[model samples]
Target chain A: MPGLEDLYREIILDHYRNPRNRGELESPPALRAEGFNPLCGDEVVIYLAMGGDVITDLKIAGQGCSISQSSASMMSAAVKGKTLAQARSTIRAFRAMMSLHGQALDGHGDGASGGGGTGAVGPEEDERTGAEVAAAEGVSLGDLEALQGVVKFPVRIKCATLSWHTLAQALDEAEKGAGPD
Target chain B: MALNDFGPPLDVARIKKDFPILDRVVHGKRLVYLDSASSAQKPLPVLDAMQRYYETTHANVHRGVYQIAQEATELYEGARAKVAAFIGAAAPAEVVFTKNATEAVNLVAYTWGRANLGTTDAMVTSEIEHHANFVPWLQLHQEKGTELRFLPLGEDGTLDLDQLDQLLDGAKLLAVTAASNVLGTLPPVRLLADAAHAAGALVLVDGAQYVPHLPTDVREMGADFVAFTGHKMLGPTGIGALWGRRELLESMPPFLTGGEMIRDVRLDGFTTNDVPWKFEAGTPPIAEAVGLGAAVDYLNGLGMSAVRAHEQALTAYAMRALKERYGDDISIHGPPPGSERAGIVSFAYKDVHAHDLSQVLDQAGVCVRAGHHCAKPLMRRLGVTATARASFSVYNDEADVDVLVDAIGQADALFG
Candidate 1:
């Protein structure tokens, strides 16, 4: 079984302590979308500045747990300069990583990052985690790979996915030329 | 885990054995279930009663013409009688079966609320009500133009009844919860009902959290309508009761009209059935009612007073234990010491979100609910987005509370 170290990687904690793009955008040029996870009252309001097909800038405004808050922090950093299609694929791949099939160990990623609490399934687990990280948007998930442990806890998947869903909504609103209403 | 630490004189181990789920392991640890406020674990008697009902007696009631059908009808009505007696209702005819407490509230809102309350009339409720009770009244007020009044919740998690009379002005109905699922605060339903009566308003008590934990007598409460669910009281799902005054139920039109809720059906129109059946439409939850009857029998056997005392000891120990262990790192939300409360402990940890706390706790096999608890208005009033809740049941003892404390400490360390 993967230890608790997998879920609480230092990179995830660093992101939680210092989130990127944490604020609101003006409503005129940017579209705002609000997302809610009723399970734990984790809410996110994503403000997007879209210049044609690219997301020029974004801000994260909400309060939640480490998985949610840090995920929002990493999400804002990852999608700031990506095109609309890339962001959508990242959301789908992140959802795939969070999906549970068989009972598996809980961990963030491989031993290469820093932690040394790997057990019997170290290589196989890291390889699988690496595959998930590599597959998300065809780019290294970096800090986002720390959330691989979330699949072991089904109830917290909503926390890890709230920000991405909200970003998707913001993109939807940005395309429609309407407010987040 | 060796000895019962919740208190003396109660058979805590034997009671734990009655619930089959307690013996199961979760995530390689003994399941320390503290989410009873969401739904209590059912015992063997309730499960057996349901299975027996299906195996021996399964038929459409009130219209069959066989020995087994009569036996099924007898068992169904017998369950209703048991429910009526369990809550001290005036008669068996006064109890109406619905899907759950939420449905019971909807029945009153649609049948009584829409027909009588409008314009100058108002429906007064409190901020502490579950959405099951709050949303229906809010919808009525919006659709019918009725004024809506809400009693405020104090900082200490109790209702501010100082201005209750003033809030009741022009209100035709006062619907409120008997207990808070989040704060575990037990409001004075009898007092509230008396004041609402003096202001010429009928009272509807949402007993979803009360009937399962406390000794309930609707007449003693002086509320005209009492709603509660069976699953919260160790019965199966799909069964709940709405006990209204016979006269009040008679005056209101049937909420649902169908096979069982009607007396006779003609070409153009149909006459409704009797008081209880008038509210019950189509095939009711017969097997679930049997399970509820067995649950009532089980509670009666254990004695409601004993059950209440056991939970009181457990909750008090939990509150003191968490505070003594964590000090200011944790804040338990509820009434002050010496005040009567249910076994629910809603708490918040310093600088940690409820979702995170719940996630870390689940790693150690501690089950708790982390969210608004379906009471968003009250959550807003409390000024917190959400709270982590640990609710006790008859099967829980101090061991469970100890496990919660250790798990929370682990979570605190991880966050630090």
Candidate 2:
């Protein structure tokens, strides 16, 4: 079985201790979305400032476990200054990396990420997923890949992914030009 | 029939043996289960009784003509009597077995609330109640436009009942928890029940936390209805009891309609069965009921007072240990170590998130519940998103607390 070292890596703890881009943004320009892990009552709020389909600035505001807080911190650092499409691809790659274990070990994906494309079904599917992950390697998960260990502990996967879900929701709202309620 | 004094104090080592899960080694360390508030580890007797029921007396209850069927029906009804006697209900018929205490409260909200409440009617609950007691009333209010009010929590971690009379003034029901699951604050339930009665309002005590820890008497509690689950009390899951006043249950309609909970039926409309049975529709959790009966027997053998005493002492030790070790760094969110609370000790250690604390503690084979504890409104009242709660049961002792304390110290070293 995987140990605590696997779950709480040094970089994750560093990110948790000194979170990046931690605060709220003005709602008029910054799209905000709140995500909640109903299982544990962990809440994450994502605020996005878009400059013409590019994420000009991103700030995360909320409280949760080490996984969640560090993830939000890492996510802000990763997605900031990236184009919308780049950010989306990064989110997908990060999610895919996090869910890689759930697919291989648990034969299921975390419900937040629909489980089909990257799931290794047979030899051919495994090769395709390998290629897909290699392509996502170009997207560069960077420090976000530190959360890949969260999958060993399935319950904490939601914790690590909560900020991502909120970020996705914020992007969705940005696309819709919807005001933060 | 009474909360009889079985004998001496619970021999911790002996008691630990009864719960086989205690023998488990998690992460190469001895299991130290402190999450009994979430669900207690079932004793061998409870497990064995369930298995024995399925092995020998597995048949449809109350519909048996054959010998095995009759035995099954007897066992099922006998379990009801055991639960009734355990809680000091007037009769077995007063105990309505449900899927869990949540369903029991829902049964009351659907049946009694539907029959008695209307738009103008108001129901008073407390901030510390589990969502089981709180949500059903809220649902009643939402569906029927009934007004819902809350008894606020005081600074001392207990309900501020100074405004109890005013809150229950025109209320039809006072739905509250006998104890706060998260804070472990044992509200003055008897006093609240009496006040509700004086105000001409029925009281529904959520005993999911209370019943497992204390010697309960529905008559003495003066509650119209008391809902408690089995899983938290060393019994199996999927079986809980709602002890209601017989007359009130008789007056209300059936909550769930189906096979077993009927005396007569027509194509147009069907007549519901007796008080408890009327609420318990379809095939009940027969084996689970048997397991609960065995659990009641186990607790009775341990003696509820003894069980309470053991938990009280252990909680005191845990509180003292935590405070002594962590000083101002640890904040235990409950009544200051005493009988005023159950064994639940919800705490936040030096800004460590509950999940993080629990995960670290898990490495030391210490299991604890880390969340809102299903009391979100209370979490908001406490001004925290979640807390790491370590609750004690009959089996838990000083050693378990020491293990918990040591593991928490490890967490402090790691996260400090």
Index of the highest-lDDT prediction: 2
Best by DockQ: 2
- Alpha-carbon interface RMSD of model 2? 2.7
For model 2, state the Cα shift of residue A146 in Å: 1.1
lDDT of 2 by residue, B1-416 (tens): 13244357789999999989999999999999999999999999999999999998899998879999999999999999999999999999999999999998999999889999999898899998898888888888889999999999999998998888899998889999888899989988889988998999999999999999999999999999999999999999999989999999999988888988899988888898877888888899999999999999999998998888878878989999999988998999978878698898999999899999999899889999999888899998888999999999988888889888878867755577
Each candidate: RMSD to true structure? 7.1, 3.9
lDDT of 1 by residue, B33-52 (tens): 99999999999999998899
Q: Which candidate has the top score in TM-score?
A: 2
Q: Please report the TM-score between candidate 1 and the true structure.
A: 0.90
What DockQ results for candidate 1? 0.38
